[model samples]
Target chain A: MKRKKLRRAEDLFFTWVMRACLMTAAVVLGLILFVIFWRGIGALSWEMVSQPPSGGFYLSQGGGGVFHAIVGSLYLAAGATLLASLIAVPVVLYIHVYSPNGRLANNLRLALDIMWGIPSIVYGAFGFALMIYLGMRASLLAGIITLALVVLPILARTFDEVVSMAPRHLHETTFSLGSTRLEFLGVLLRQTVPGLLTAVLLAFGRGIGDAASVLFTAGFTNNMPEGLLRPVASLPLAVFFQLGTPFPEVQARAYASALILTVIILTISILAQLSISRLGRHVIR
Target chain B: MEATPDTTIRPLPAKKIAASRLSRWRWFKDAGARTMLGATAVIICLLIVVITAALTARSWPILSAYPLAELLTGQVWQPMRGLFGFAPFIAGSVAVTLVAMAFAVVPAVFSGMYLAEYTSSRTRSALKPLIDLLVGIPSVVYGLWGVLFIVPLVRDHIGPLSDRTLGQFFPFFARTNPSGYGLLAAGFVLAVMVFPLIVAVTEEVLRSIPREMRETLLALGATRWETTRCIMRRAALSGTLAAIVLGFSRAFGETLAVMMLIGNTPRIPSSLFDAAYSLPALIANNYGEIMSVPLYESALMGAALLLLIVVLGFNVMARLVIMRLTKRS
Candidate 1:
């Protein structure tokens, strides 16, 4: 009886310890969110969001905002998303429709998995090399191309899973109806549209929030993005530069930029989740 | 149905139907998609190849100038002085990654076990989303948080406490200056950043174990702790190892957070308190000014090449382990 009681006590202790471990993660996340919001709220203002940085902005004299960074991030991410989609959609369709369960498809999946694991910094290095070879300086177009390469594998793999989730019978039924392969693909695309959109948004979220991948290719500028040939500033770089300075106000701006980045990521994540559920209703297991 | 059958007595001409189906637009539509998709696949493969080729080509100048052995084994890394030994950076990378893994492994394992074996569905649902959010949070945000909170906390609290308590016995804990912008700070941030990935992967591994095995262990009078620690954990050992490796790869390749918090001094740290430099951090920190010097770009590219090779090696090994585990279970 005494031994039984001791075992029970040990079990209770173990359970509580595990609970605490789980709670620690939650607490850390909560703490990060709280710290960012608390530190950044004061620095946020209308002019800060709407206007570009004025002269001597990095000195933390507080005469500038993050409009240029925001616009640049959006433009780069949007352009990359569009380019990635053009490649990813066809690749996904080809794997699932044209050559299902073939060696090419399997190899493609493996390649994408490997590519997905490559660090963003490596992509930046590769992009830098390419830009040098092409006699191109840092420009919006360069950044877009680099980001597209970074996100293509990600978008392709995600859409592959989404397309694969359609019931096998759906494909069989379309083919059995004497419809052409193109029509069958059209039906499949319609069925997975929500998931495809979610995948694109997720890739966009990743592209915009990333810093290392674009650090070399984009080349920061204080002005708004003027043309495809000109350099563009992004939020992640802005945060990095601002925080690196010795001035306190610049650090505050960094926090505010982080806050904006966090919001964008969270919003994208929530949207992705919502779309998954909506797609679930349409998907036939 | 009977009316349609009677109407079908007058059939359409086969030649006309064939001609319509074989129209240029239809044939083009049918063939165009395959060509487009095939081209896209080729592009995907070509992109990966191009990246590899570009890194190698850019790195060749330095690689050809300096022997690989010297670069890997030399001590110093002064670019301006033309001394480009990557040993310090390599050691720094390994040290910080090991420190982060040391801090992160226990909590990640326990959290994974809790989620996999103990939690109710409701609690799991609530908690999983939060963990997923952690994975989505950008590294820059982690860096910002580290600078704002972790650096000060470590410098003010942990650094002093460690110096007074453990510094005497273990040199690893000793601090000369204790500014807290060093391996310990970087490790803490990396630990937090990688915790979610480790937990997620481990939880999946544990959950893959058959329910029957778990029930049989419990029926044989094993406690829940024994069942999980002895039976389930052993079964998933390879997978857990893979998870650890995956987390390590992430820590090794991490750039922004480490750069921000690691007090980017290129030295081989003797204690956790000393500042260090990592390959990725070095590349990111110097890429902007790299073009000023003749061979500086090549040297940085060499570092990047080393990082890429190491990260890719780890990823391939982890994927293989995962594949084997999946086959087993």
Candidate 2:
């Protein structure tokens, strides 16, 4: 009876410690959200979204905004997502439809898994080296290409999972009907459309939020991205550069940019989750 | 061409029959789609190869100019003086990663255990999304938080407290400058950044344990704590180790946040309060300025190559361990 009581007490202690760990994680996340919103809310405005920073805006007081950065980020992320999707979709389709259980398919998946774990900084270095060798300057093109590389593996892997979850009988039936491989791929695509969108959105979120990968390649500019060869500013870099200044207003703007970035990411994540559930309902098994 | 009566009836024309056969063959033989996707797959594989080759070719100048030992082991990293040693940054990276792991592991493991063993399905579902969101938060935002909140708190409170309490005996906490930007602050931010990843991996590891094992322990009159401590913990040990290794790789390659908080000084830090540089930080900080100098770009590329090799090695080992665990489970 005494030993039983001691065990009960130990169990209670273990449970409480675990609860505290959960509480700590929740509190840290809450603190981050609270701090960012509190610091940035006052500086967010329509004018801040519409106007670009004037000269000496980092140091001097002025009514300026991150319009350039916002536009540049959108363009860069959109371009990267498009490029990644163009390559990743075909690869995933090939794996799922053409060679579902082949050695080549498995090896490809493994390679992508490794690529997924690579650090963004290495991607940046690779992009930078390639640019120098090709005599290309820091421009929107360079940033897009680098970001595409970063997002490609993620998009491909996610899409592969979605495609694999498709009912096997669906493929067998289509093949039994004497459908061409392309037509069969078309059917699979229809089944996984929601999942494909979620993968693209997730990739877009990653591409937009990343800073280290594009820091050297993008080469920040004050103006919006005018052409493929022109330099572009992004939200992450904007926050980095603005916060480095010694001015209060600029720092506030940096927080606002971070707030913007956070909201975008949050929205994408929520959408992705919703689509996953929606797609789950479509799964036969 | 047969003009007999049965042939003249011509139930089906030879050309029409040939067309149907060709269509049937088209269903099974899709050379166009096959080649297209096969080429796309090849391109995907080539990306990794190209990146490795590019990094190697760019780093060749530095590798040839300076011996590998000298580049890796030399203490000073004075670029202007043509000294390109990576020892300080490498040490800094390892130290910061170790400190970050130290802060993150306990809480992560506990939380993971709670979610896996103690919590209801509803509670687990509710907390899982929150953790996922935390993982999605940008590193730049984390860096901003570090600069604004963590740095000040460390400088004003933790640094002074450490100095007063541990200064007499421990040299690691003895020299506190109160600058707030050093190894400790960087580690704290990194811990926060990597917390979600560790939690996710650990929870997965714990969840993969067979229910029969837990039931056996409970049936033996073991309390919940005893069952977890004696049986489940041992079962999931390898997975938890793999989780820690994966998180360490993440912390090691982290850049912007560490750069903001680590003070970016090129020296081996003797104390947690001292400033230090990391490999990624070094590359990010110097890439713009090094373009004007001759072997400087090569040296930076060399540092990047070293980082890539180290991270890849860790990732491969972690992958193998996880694969083994999954196979066993």
Candidate 3:
């Protein structure tokens, strides 16, 4: 009877401890957001988001903005998401449609998982090496290719997960109609469109937020975004560069850029959540 | 009554495509898709080999110039004088990753248990979006938060408090540096980034535990805590380890955030408060700058290659352990 009481007491104690742990995590997240917002809100303004940096902007000479960075980040992340999708879709489709149970598919998933584990800086180094070999300069194209590599495995795996979640009857319906493997894939793809969109958004969020992979490949520029072959400023790198300066105003700009980035990510996540709900409605499980 | 009308030369069901009616164009598309998709899969599978090979071939110049052992173990890191030692960075990487894992694992495991065993499905669904937001926040922003909040908190509270108290128990707790930008701060920042990640994986692993296992424990009159302890230690051990390993791989290769808060001094640090350098930091800070020295770029590339190898090695080890565990059970 005593031992039973002791066990009961221990159970009650640990339950509270676990709940406290969950609360602690949530509180930390809240504090982080609060800090960013507190420091960054002062720097937020219409002109700040509307214009690119003017002459002597880092020197705090004139009106400055991160419009270029906002644009550049969108362009680079979209291009990367597109490039990654081009490769990821075909691979995921082949795995699910052609050989879902084959050894090759298993190996392919493992490879992608490993690739996903690699750091962004290594991708930058590899991109730099490839650029040198190709006799190319730090251009948007180079950054796209490098960032694509960083985003590829993530896109592929998320796509695979979404595709896997597709109702099993999708296979029965598609194949039962005397469809070829590719035709069945088309039907399945149509069903998981919402999940696929969510996956793309997730990958885009990852690609846009990473600064290391594009540090060298996508050369930074203060001017507005130009052609594909030219340098483009990115939001994360903008935050990094502004913070590197000694001037207080420039550092404040860094805070502002971080705020913008945080907001963008929050929006993407909200969209992803909406799409996830829509996914259930789209398919009859 | 409609049997005669059924023979009115009805066309094939629009959706049900039969092989006999497959047009020449449709045939080409089918064949093309197979060839394209199969080839893409093959290339994607070979990507790991391609990345490893590229990094190695690029960094071989430095490895060939100096003995591998010396490059890895030597202390000094003067790039201008042709000295290329990575000992400090490696040690720093290990220390920071250790600190991050230490701070992250407990909270993550507890949260995972709560979500897996306690929460209703409604609560779980509502909480997922919050977790997703946490996971999606960029590391740079986390670094920004660290600079603004954690660094100052350490400078004001943790640094002095630990010095007065923890220093009595152990000398290492007494820090020489008070700027609050050091291993502990970096670890804290990194922990925030990885907490949600570990939680996600842990929840997956714990939920994957068979219902029968839980029922059996309860049927044996075991309390909730007792059952949980047994299950976590035995049944969920491998998955939890894999989760931690995955978290470590993430913390190991993280660059920008650690660089911002680690105070970027290239040396082995004795105290947790001392500034230290990391491998990813080494690559990120020096990769694009002047390459006047002959083997400077090579040395940086070597750091990148080493980072790649370490993270991938851990991932592969975890994969093997998981494969073995799943096979056995």
Candidate 4:
């Protein structure tokens, strides 16, 4: 009876410890999101969204909005997404249909895997060097190219997987019926358009959220983007530079900005996941 | 021709010629697509060459002027005056990473093990998505959080500890005001930023352990903890280690959060309260500010090259470990 009681006590203790671990994990995730949202929403306002950031807080001097940063972030993300998709889609399609043989396909896949493994900072360095060499000083075009390079591997890999998993019989039948390569591509692309869009959205989310690579190449400028070749501010960069200072209201604004950025990223990720599952369900059915 | 045998043949001008022309064109298009595919395969490889060339070209001036030892071993990083030793950045990067990893690994791995080995299916479903949300949160957001909530707490509490301990002797510790923008704060924020990744990867590895082993251990009258320790944990050690390494790499490469939180002061961390810098942070801060045809430019590029090499080295090592494990498994 004594031994059994001891064993039971030990088991109960371990179980409770394990339960606490689980609880902590859940709480950690919850707290991170909650803190961001709580602090961020408190500082957010229409005026804050409409004007460019200036020197003082809203409660005191009516601090400016993140309008320029938002626009710049959107422009850069869109530009990078467009460039990456333009490069990745054709490459992914070719790898899927034309390069079914071992050497070409395997090499491409390995290149992408390596690229994915490469750090974002390296991409920034390369971008800075390349841009400087080309006589472009911290320009938006440089930022776009840098982000596009970093995202290319991710887009290609995801698109390639989706396109390959697409109905093979459709391709075989089209080929046997003497349809041209372009026709086959058109049909396959139409079928996989949603999946490809999801890939682009994921890349856009990553690009917009990324700050380090953009920091060197994008160079935080407060002015609105005059053109593709000019420097511009971004949401991530603004939060990064502003949050480190000693002011309370500035910090609050930073929280709001951070909250906005996180929301955008989370929304895109959730949407991507939903589309992936939807695609999976379609394939299964 | 066989179809024509069934009825009166319709007259056509050069039917064989048209078929041949069509086949030739189809072949050409196929060939073109194949060529495009091959070109895509070469693109990344080509990028590797381009980057290497650009970096080496930029570093030529500094390398020609200074010996390799001075560049690696010198203490100061005065790029404007042609001094280009990145030891401070290197030390700062290492110290911050070490502290962050120390804070992150234990809690993350324990949580992962608990989730994988202890939790029920319903619980998993409810909690897993929440954990993923942590991973999806942007680094900039984490930076903001650190700046606002965490920095103040550190400043008010932990910063005083350093002041109390080393108040008389060390000037650096005396300067330990509760700014929350220092190495410790950055390290904690990095720990938070990387926590989800470590937990998720470690959990997946732990979950992959076969149930039969655990069942057998349990049937032998071992408790759940005993079963996990003797069977599941032992089996997943290498995988857990790999997850740790991967997490380390993520923390190492994290630039935005660390740069923002870590007071970008290029000095060795004399105390936990002291501020420090990191390689990626330094690059991000100075790369834009440096001008062309200057020693600062070369030094920055050189540091960047070194950082790139280090990150690449870690990735290669991680991949190698993964490959060996795969072969063994």
Candidate 5:
């Protein structure tokens, strides 16, 4: 009887601990989101998003904004998403069509999984090495290439999963229609278009928010992105640099930048949701 | 030409000629798609090899010049004088990663269990998105939160509290840092960053387990916790381990949040409060100086290579384990 009672007590204790862990996670998320909003909302303003940083803005002479960083992040992520999708789509389609479960296909999947696991900082280092070998500088073009490397695995893997989840019957139907393999590919893609969009947005969000990979490759500048070959500022790096300043106001601006970034991500998630739900109708499902 | 008796070779009709031309074009297009798309797949596969090669080529100079053991174990990190010992960075990275994993794994597992077993489908669905939000938050923003909140908590509370109590028992808690930016802060920030990943994967794993196991255990008069500890946990062991490994790899490679709070001192930390340098942080911080020094770039690249190899090793192991678990399920 005593042993049974002790077991019950132990179980009760374990249950409570589990509950506590759940509460802790919820509280932590709440705290983080709360802190960001509370500190950030005050510093956010139209001017903050409209103009580039003035001279000595780091010193809190700040009549300027992180406009360049915002725009540059968009430009960088947009270009990278385009490049990654161009490559990822073709590769994913090929994997699905040609050799769905062959050694090459399996290895390719593993390769992408490994790539997805690589730290952005290592990607940054690798990109820097490649840039040096190519005699390239830390310009927008270089940053785009590096960021593409970072997001490619993500795009490819997510799209691959989407493509794989596609009902096999679609393939049969396409073949039964006496369509060529390319036409079958077209039909498969049409069915998974929403998923592909979701994958692209996911990659774009990841690319835009990443800091380590772009820290060296995307050299910062106060100017607006003048050309693809010129150095460009990014939101993550902007927040990092701004917070590094000794001035409180400059640091506050960092919070504002964080808020902007968070808002952008939130928007992307919203779009992903909308895309999946509203776009599900046309999908073969 | 002979199939249709009436349509025997009557000067090769125009329709037949056009049909043959179109079929040839279609065949060419099919082959073109096959080869081109196949090449893309091959290129994607070669990407990892290329990354490894590029990193090795870049870091070869430092590796060839310095003895391997000395470079890895040497303590001093004076790059100006060409002393690029990676001992401190390695220790710092390992320590911080360990700390992060320790803090993260239990809570993550317990929460994952709760979500997977106890919660209704409705609650699970509602909370899963919230957990994903944690994963989606940018590391730099996490860094910002650490700087504003966690660093100060460490400086004022955790630092002094540990120094008074646990400090007496363990040297690891003995030091009281004034700046409050150290391994502990970095680990805490990274813990928050990796928490969601572990939870998501663990929950996924647990959910994939056969529901019959739980029903049988409960029907045998087992409490929910008993069922969880014995049957559910046992079944989900490999998956949970994979989750932990995945989380560990994620924490190990985290750069931005850690960089913000680790104080960037180039020495191995003996205590949680002592400032430390990490390999990723080293690469991130030393970008500007790489151009000035001769082997500085190579040294940093070497650090990157070390980090990459470690993360890659963990990921491959985790992948294999996950594959095993999935196969069993």
Candidate 6:
């Protein structure tokens, strides 16, 4: 009886500890979401959403909405994702279907893995130097191109995994049918569409969340992006630049902005997860 | 095996057409495929080379202009007057990372241990998404929280508590600021940021330990904690350290949140409350406005190279540790 009581006490201790840790994580997440929403809801007026931030950040008055930032972020992220996807798909397909030896493939994979270790700030510095040399001067083209470079390795690595999952029989069957290179590519592309979409969305999520890489390359301009070479503001940069000021209202607005950005990313990540599972179901079926 | 005279696809000579279509397309067997694959490998390798070259080119100008002694030992960072000492940035990065790791490692390991060894599948499944959500939130958002909430709360609450505790033990803790968004606060937030990575990797490593080992240990009447602490943890030590190092790398490279929270003053932090500068932040804030051309740019790249070296060093060390562990095990 005494031993049983001791065992029960120990179990109780363990359970409570686990519960406390989970609860702490939940609380931190909740607190961030709550503060963002609570402060941001009032700041998220239609005008704020529609107009651009003016010369100065004003919470209640003239500095307008996040329209340019929203549009710029979407355009740049979309452009980067599209470019990265296009480049990665072909390379990944070549690696998956045509590569003869494993040694070269292993080296490529390690190179991509090491790319992840390089800091975003370093990427920004590189991009900044290149942009100045190319005379892009903090334009949209500079920003989008830099973003594309930053996300290229990530997209390639993810797509390589997704493409490698294509069944060997599919390739052999296509070969047996004497499909041309283009025809084989079409077939492989059709099969990997869902996985590729997931990879793109994941890339998009990453692009959206990135800030430091964009700051030096994509100079913040209040005006909406007009051409491929115009300056633009992104959500991360907007939040980052605004958070350090003395204005409480501007600070609160930053919170709301962050919340919105996180929600968008969270939605994309969930969608990617869902698509992968959906792809699994299709495979099983 | 001569080609047919009426071959429709291409008007080739009989000898050229003698090769089967399969052999023609067999790039893997043919030199063409080998060349293409080899070229692809070269392209990937070139990207690494280009990035390294870019970093080197960027740093070269600055390093040439500034002597090594001044860059390494100098404290003041006046870009206008052409004086840039990166020692304080290095110190700040080390300070924040160490404090963050301290805050994050203990709880992260314990929680990871419990999740892996103690929790039921249902709980694990339900709790995992929540943890993932924490991980997915962007670092800038963390900075926002640090600024608006954490700073105030720490200033109003934590500082007093620290003051009272340190009042008995140390004089340094007495002159604390309420702004919790200093080195300690940034570290705390970073700990949260890296918690999921450590927990996930550590849990994965722990779970890979054979179930029978746990059962065998338990069959000897050891308590769950005893089994976990002694057998599972010991076995998974390499993985745990790797996870921690991975967390360290992530924290080290993290820029936006750390930049926003760590008050961007270029002073050596005597106390946690004093504003600090990190390498990434220093580059981010000044890279755009660098006036001395190569000198400032090189300093920034050198800082990046420094940060890169730290992360890569950790990665290499972790790999070595895991290799050693595997050999011994």
- Name the top DockQ candidate: 3
How many angstroms is residue B327 displaced in model 1 relative to the true structure, after the best TM-score fit? 5.1
What fraction of the real A-B contacts shows up in model 1? Answer: 0.56
* Per-candidate local distance difference test: 0.85, 0.85, 0.87, 0.76, 0.87, 0.75
Per-chain TM-score of chain A in candidate 3 equals 0.97
What does candidate 4's lDDT look like per residue over B1-329, in tens digits? 45555332111222332378776666666667767656766776567557667777787788788998898878888766777777888888888888888888888887788778887998886676767667667778877778767788788876787677776677656646457788888998888877777787678777667778788999998887777777545787877787777778778778888887888888878776678989888877776567753787787778777776676666656645544443343
> Higher lDDT: candidate 4 or 6?
4
- B4-64, model 2: which lDDT tens digit per residue? 5632111122233336777645633565778878988877877777888899999999999
Candidate 1 colliding pairs: none
Better of 2 and 5 by TM-score: 5
Which stretch of 10 consecutive residues in model 2 chain B shows the poorest summed lDDT?
B6-15
DockQ, structure candidate 2: 0.53
> How many pairs collide in each candidate, listed in order?
0, 0, 0, 3, 0, 7
Task: Tell me the fnat of candidate 6.
Answer: 0.38
- Give lDDT tens digits, candidate 1, residues A222-283: 99999999999999999999998999888888888888888888998888888877766866
User: By TM-score, highest first, what's the ranking?
Assistant: 3, 5, 2, 1, 6, 4
**How would you encode candidate 5's per-residue C-alpha lDDT over B247-267 as one tens digit per residue?**
988888889999999989988
Please write out the lDDT profile of model 3 over residues B8-31, one tens digit for every residue.
222234344434455545656776
TM-score of 2: 0.92
Per-residue lDDT for A23-115 in model 4, tens only? Answer: 776776677778889888998888767888666543435568787888889888899989989888987777666556456676676567557
Docking class of 6: acceptable
Model 6 per-residue lDDT tens digits across residues B1-329: 98779522312332343368764554333345446646866687577568667777777777777787888889988766778888899888888888789888877877788789888998887788777677777778887777777777777887788777874587545534455657877878888888887887678678767778899889998778668877645688877888799788878888988887887778777666656888888888886667655367667778877777687677656645544444343
Name the candidate, 3 or 5, with the larger lDDT value: 5
CA shift of A100, model 3, Å: 1.3
**Model 6, span A8-42: residue lDDT tens:** 68867876776687678788878878876776777
Candidate 1 DockQ category?
Answer: acceptable
True contact recovery of candidate 3: 0.76
- State in Å the error of residue A109, model 5: 1.8
Instruction: Please report how far candidate 4 places residue B55 from its true position, in Å.
Output: 2.3
Task: Write down the C-alpha DockQ for each prediction.
Answer: 0.48, 0.53, 0.56, 0.43, 0.53, 0.44
